[model samples]
Target chain A: MSGIQDFVVLTLVKAAPLIYAALAGVVCERAGILNIALEGQLTIGAFTAVAVSFATGNPVIGLLAGVVAGALVGLLLGVAATRFGVDQIVAGTGINLLALGGAAFGLTVVFGQPGASAEVSALGVPGERGLIVGAFVAALLLHLALYRTPWGLRTRASGENPRAVRSAGIDPRNVRLIATMLGGALAGLGGVYLSLGELDLYSDGMTAGRGFIALAAVIFGRWTPFGATGAALGFGALAALQFVLQRSGVPSELMQALPYLAALAALTGIAGRARAPQADGVPYTE
Target chain B: MIRGLAIGLALALFAAAAMLLAGANPLLGFWALFRGALGGVPQISETLVQTTALLFPSLAVAFAFRAGLFNIGAEGQLVIGGLVAGVIGARLETSGLIAIPLLLIAGSAGGAAWGAIAGVLRARFGGSEVIATLMLNIVAALLANYLVVGPLHSPGVAGPETAELPHSSWLPALLPGTRLTVALLIALALAFVLRWVFARTVFGYELRAVGDAPEAARRAGINLAKTAFVTMALSGAMAGLGGATIVTGVLHRFNVSLSPGYGFIAIAVALVGDLDPLRIIIASFAFGILQSGALSMQALAHVPKDVVSFVEGLAIVALAARRFVAGRKQMTALAPE
Candidate 1:
């Protein structure tokens, strides 16, 4: 029972950021925007949030800065992807690489440090239990917004069949842009949680492929909010378990490799059936 | 293409800005970066030193990407390969002629097995190779850490690294006092063989066909499952050889940070080379120069060392964006056709 509780707590904590990023991914993708830039968005958000929070001595400001940073990146991606008709995957990847560049430069300018920013005072968001609960509510509400609202209808329509939606007098590009921005804002919030809650500082490449894990969540969940949330938790369990097993003096190296191995297993197991949104990587020029 | 040039230029300028912060002229910084990396025989020899560390991984990444399989696990694969080398280096008592090749083969086999595991999972279970490979990289790294630090660590050394191999077993240095070894020539030979395999062989055609469209290849009886396994295995061998080269040629023993993410950077190099082995030479030199120069940028400008890393990140972004733009244009062009 104690072991189960510990696993549950750790899993929930680990899953929170993934849930956040996956949820955001769901929104953008549903709006017919294929976003590979979530990784970059998260990195930028974490970088900005860390610098601001550390500089201002306020976590709230850091959170806001993170959102702004992510949204800015989203806006760039959206503009290029939608307006200029860039390949969605390529543009998203570019966005990620650009974020890496920006963050590296920012580290020099803002932190006067190498590799990472110095430790900062972090504001307490909900911890283990609170994160799961807050994320659940947020996911549910966002899911509702995605399905029930007028925008939701348009967004799904765009993703499912953009031509039909356009024929119905909707602008797919605009919807995709808005959705992408919204998703980026949420992912940024998740980045804040990672830095603030986990390490209380920011470092180079600190997200450590969490963005990609969230991607797996999005795919595992078939772009549904609840599905993604669940997938995040599953991956999280694997992650937390790896850490736990590492402490047992077992060849923790192998254990350390376990979560990734598990994720790989999950990816291979589900890939053929999970169809990406129709025309997901296609740029809608017209 | 022009946009890519612009982006590259913009990134180079930003790097200059970083250099300026260190109180060095950007031009001078650029000169130092180039000079320190490849100004003379010694510098060029030194660059080759780093080149050996890079060569195997680049080939590995390029090979997989050619097959449309993204093997982000090269980092992980290399780690395991190094561990294999480390383990063998500590344990083996045979002559260099036998033991060195044994260690090399062991490293290749270790990496191949690891990569094959991911490949099998993806092919047999319908998993996403990208995610699986990425995750496996971390797993491999950790497993190595555990082995060296806990189970296989040298009794003499306080660190997690294994005991050094016999002196006779170590790679013969090409230049005295330099790290460059025969691995550079071997990598080039491997690259040529890989190019031939990719272009002239039946397996090459089959792999390309599958990469172009798996369903079509399946319909045509390409045995894609086996192909994936084989490609990953080949990739692992190349990457593992890269790790062994690093150990035997440079570090002369396994240690952490031996990779410094050469595996990941290979992604960028593969792209910049357009995944062409011949083109990779130019791309490799360019990247190698930038990396070596970045050290000088750090040394002279007092800028943090990541300025080169930022450039690499920029290059990836530019390449991806360029691909996207090109794809969009092609789509439109094809649509009109």
Candidate 2:
């Protein structure tokens, strides 16, 4: 009983970051943007959170800094995709690469270290139970915002038929831009959770492939908030299982691949069924 | 082409500014980068070697870009190919003449197989090749790590690598006393061949049509699934060949650091080259200079090597934005008054 409870708790904690990221994906993708820059946004957010927290000795300030940094990146992506008509995938790839190199540069420049930063103040509660709880609350709030609010209708409409949204007197481009910024903020919080909650330090590439995994969850969930959250939990369970089975002497490297493998399996297994939003990747030309 | 050059030049200037801020003389750093990449015979040979390693993957990326498929899995495909080549190179005891071709074929086959997984998923299941390929890359990396640290671990060797290949399996140097090997020649030949294929071949025409308009190509009786499969396989094979060359021509043993993100950099090369095979040759060499010079710049000028990556990423984003600007103009021109 204790073992099962521990597994459940660990799974929830592990899923917290992914839950935030996948929710971010749901927001942008639902608003007709691809948001492939999640990885880069996560990286920048993680670095900012740790750096600020280390300097200020306040985890809350660090978290807010991460959110702002992520939102800025998201806004840049939004402007590029909407105003300049850059292909979102290419733009996202460039941002990811830039974030990686930029983070390394920051490590050397700000912290005077290479690879990883020194430990910073973590949140008071152990194991980041607060973040996990906050993720669930955020998921619920996002679901309501996406389903019940007038803004939600406009966002979905912009994704499905921007012309209709524009005809209805709402600027679909602005909606998309705002949604993308929100998405970035959420992904930033996810990064903050990883750095301040999960590990309490920033390591180069510490997010590993969680950003991409959230992307898979977005697809697997068929662009629904709750669906994405559920998929994230499923992925999180697989991650927890890897830890549980680590003592069985299976090569940890192989086990390390579980979440990605599960994502691939989920994608392939559910392919041709989960239809994305109509104008998901289309650049809005004025 | 002109615009890409302008963007590259602009990014270089920006990077120089960054170097100045980092406490290095931008002019001296630029000069050092130039000399390290192109000055002496040895430097030129190393540049060619780096170009050889980059060319195949750039071409691989270019091939897929032509087909409108983003093959981000080139990193994984290259790793799997190298792993196979390392295993085969270590085990095979044939003459160089036989062993070389055999290893190359085996390596390409491994990459093709890895590429085909994403291809198959996309063709049959309608999965996004981008996500599938990205995930597969991680799996390939882990799989390679597992093999090296476990089954293929060399006896008495501390690193997670296979045993060194026999001397007979090593690709002979094209320039004696230098790292330059026949791989450069092979890469050059393959570039021309790919360019010709894109220009003259029926399959190439069909693939382009499919990429340009899948629905129209389907109406014209092109099998979309088969084309997707073929394009991805061929792309993967090219990246695989690159991995094999790295093993036979340079490393002679497989290690995790065999590729310092060459596969990812190949995306920038392909995009900057505008997905043109011939142009990719020039782009490959340009990036090859940066890759080789970065280390020397770091060592001599105190400029961090990550600056090259920053420039590469900047170039890609700027180039992509340039495309958007051009696209906006086209849209305006086509819009009715």
Candidate 3:
């Protein structure tokens, strides 16, 4: 019984960050900006959280700083896509490279070393539990806000038909920019959970493609807030299973690959013929 | 051309700012970078080797972009190709003449198969190639790690790499002592061939029509699904062949860390070259200088070598505008009145 309880706890702990990132994807794609920069946002958030924590010795402030940093990176993507008319995928790829390179550079500058930073103040276990609960709360709130609010209608309408939003006297670009920022903030908090809630220090590649995994969760969830959270929890359970089955002679690499493999399988219509938002990844031009 | 020059200047400025932030002299960093990349015969040869390594994937990326498909899984395809080549080369005992072509073909086939997975998904299921390719990249890495380190582990090898290929399987050297080999010539010939194909082939015209105006191409009776599958497979073959060359010519074995994001960087190269196969060779050389010079820049200038990638990332964002404008122009030109 205790083992079952522990597994449940571990699943929530693992799923927290993925839930945040998947939510980020849901919001951005729903608003017509395919935020391929979610990985970059996560990287920046994790790095900034650690750097600020190391500087001020306050984990909470680091948390806030991380969210703001992520939002700024999201803003960069929004401006480039909406204002400069840059290809979103290209811009997202660029941002991923930039965030990775910038963080590696930052490690040398801030920590006076490469590869990792020294152990710093962390949010501890209670904070971690709080975040796990907050993830569920966030999902519920997103579901409500997306389906029940006027802003949600505008955001969804923008994704389905941005020209219609424009005809209604609201610039869809602003709507997209705002959605990206909100999504970025959520993803930033996810990063904070990884660095602060689970670990005490920052290491290069610590995020370890979790950002990409979150992308899979988004698709599996069919681009809905509650649905994405549920998919994230399933992935989290798989991660927990990996830990349990590590000593059972099963290769961990294969285990680590299950989500990606599932995503590939999903592309074959095994998951469903669920359609994405019409204007998703399509840049709206004036 | 002017846009390329401006982007170069901007990258230089960004590099300088990064140096300043790192407490290094920007001038010293620049000097070290150029000196390391072009100082002597050895340095230049090393730069060319880097150039050769980058060329295959850059051209592969340009190929798919011309077909309006983003083949982001070049990294994965390259790994699978190298893995197949390395595994086959390790065991095959034959004359160099026979072994080289066989191994290269195997590598290309491996990459094409990997690429065809995404192609099938897009062609049959009407799925997004972006997500499929992205997922495949991770799967490729994991599969390579499993194969090399587990069942296919090379005897007497301590690391997660295959046994070195027999000497007969090795690609003949172009420069006796340097790592540069006939692979450079092969890559150059491929670029010329690709240029001709794009300019003069009926298939090329069909591909361009699909990329520039998909609806119109469909109306013209072009098979969009078949074209997507074929283009992706061919793109993957180019990247796979690049991997095979690396295994046979450079490393003589496959290691899981075969590419350091070359596939992703190839996107920048393709875009910078304006998706022109011939011009990608030039772009590859420019990026190659950075790849070879970064180590020296770190050692001598105390600047982080990551500055190169950072600047490359900035360059991608800045240059992406060009692709957008070009794509828009093509669409407008082909739009029905």
Candidate 4:
């Protein structure tokens, strides 16, 4: 029981970033935007957060920097997809490539390293109860904001039938931009949790495809915040179990593949039913 | 064509800028990079051989893209194809004449089966092929790792790699004094065949129609389900062939690190190629050159080879960003009907 409890604890901690990222996707997608840039945003955010924390020796500062970095990318994507009427998917892909390239370039320009940023000053902040609690509270709050507010109603309306809402005299494009930027901030927080809270270092490809899995969670959870977070936790549990089970006679390589398989199962199991925002993958106007 | 040339020019400028920023003379770096990639007979040979790997996988991706499916699982297909071919080629040393073709067939069959799994799910269950294939890639990768580590640990070999393949199973060399094998010719021939099938067949026409508009394709009495299955199966077969050739032709042994995101890069190649087979051959070589040049760039500039990744990233970002600027809907509307 203790061992199980320990695994659960570790799993929830690791699950924090995934939960944030999935909900981030959910937020943007709820506003009728598919945020495929989540991966790139997370990667750049992690890189920046780690870099800032290293430079400033403050985790809070790093967190803020991460959010800012993510929001910058979000702003570009939002403008491209909304104001410019670009295909949101392609714009998102651009964001990914840009972020990936930007991070790599930054690494080279700043530290002259390839795989990792210079050993940064580590942040011990949110190392325990604060981190897990932060995710749950966020899930609850985002769920509330998404369902229980008039603004939320407008946002949902924008996603479902934006043309109708646009005729109602509100700019759906503005709403989408806000939604995407907020999602970016949340995703940036997830990145901070990785580089600052857990590992205290930044490495190349450190998100390790978690952001894509978070997209899968967004699908698995059918675009709901809590559901997405739940799915994220499920993935995190499998990930944690892979670590735990590796010690119990399983080959390390086999364990390495289990999280991906579990993610696939989760994606396929719920994909047919993972309804998107009616306007998802479509550029919004007005 | 003009746009592509402009893109190449922009990328050249970007590469030069990157080189200068890395504290190396941009001219010197470009000289080394270009010379390394396309300088001589030897260099060109290496570039083409690498292009052989990139072309097959990219074509695999481009074929699936034509069906509105993104198969990021080429890595898995490549590994499984290689593993089956390698294991069979080395271990099942029965008759060379029989075994060589059999290994290729078996390897491709393994890749097709793996690819078809995602196709089946997408076709019948409406599962996202992207997720399914990508996950399967990791699964296949680890499976290869397990095979190398446990069962195929190469007859007293300490590391996780298979033993040398039987000489008879090896692919015939395409050139003297180079590792270039008959696989290049085979890949080129298949690409030509793919082009013919795409241009001439009812199947290919329907594939285009389905990709253009799925519901419209169905309205035209085209069997949407059939198209999905066949296209995915064929796409998987291409990637499978990619894997098999590497085993019997290139590596001749299943190594776990046999690929480094070759599958994802292939997606970029497919897109940049505009999903045309002839264009894919060229696009594959372009990327092959980038990869080949990257190593030399690292050695000359003391910059890591990942700098090439930045350039690749810049190119992808620019291409996708072009959609955001020139914009797809605008161009579609402007085109003369």
Winner by TM-score: 3
> What is the two-chain DockQ of model 3?
0.66
lDDT (10s digit) by residue, model 4, range B130-237: 667867876887788898787666786666667777888888887877768888888888889889978999888887776766666677997766666777777777
Q: Using alpha carbons, what is the TM-score of model 4?
A: 0.89
Please state the interface RMSD for every predicted structure, separated by commas.
4.0, 3.0, 2.0, 4.0
What candidate 3 gets wrong by more than 4 Å, as runs, is B322-337
Instruction: Report the lDDT tens digits of candidate 3 across residue range B71-119.
Output: 8789889889999999999999999999999999999999999999988
Error of 2 at A69 (Å): 1.3
TM-score-based ranking: 3, 2, 4, 1
Count of clashes, each model: 13, 0, 0, 0
Candidate 1 structure quality by residue, lDDT tens digits, B1-337: 6765786688789788766764568887787888888888777887776666666787898787666576767887888888888788877877889887888888888888888887886567645455567667767766776777776778887776777877876887788877778878888888788889988999998877666666666779878778878988889888988888777767878886678778777767777777778777667777877767677767765666666766676566456433313322222122110
Tens-digit lDDT track of model 1 for A1-286? 9989989888888888889888888888887776767888888888888889988999778878988888888887887778765556545655666677678777877887668888887766544345457678879988899888998888888887888878988788888888888888878878877777666788888877777777768877888999899888887888778777765756545543544554565555444566657755556756
DockQ of 4: 0.42
Better of 1 and 2 by TM-score: 2
Q: What's the C-alpha lDDT at position B250 in model 2?
A: 94
Question: What is the per-residue lDDT of model 2 for residues A1-286, given as tens digits with 9 covering 90 to 100?
Answer: 9999999988998899999999999999999888888888899899999999989999989989999999988898888778776777777777788778878767766687779999999775663878888898999999999899999999999888888998888889999999989999999999999998888899998988888889988988889989999999988898898889888978888767876776677656644556778777666666
User: Alpha-carbon error at B132 in model 3, in Å?
Assistant: 0.6
Off by over 4 Å in 2: A124-127, A269-272, B321-337
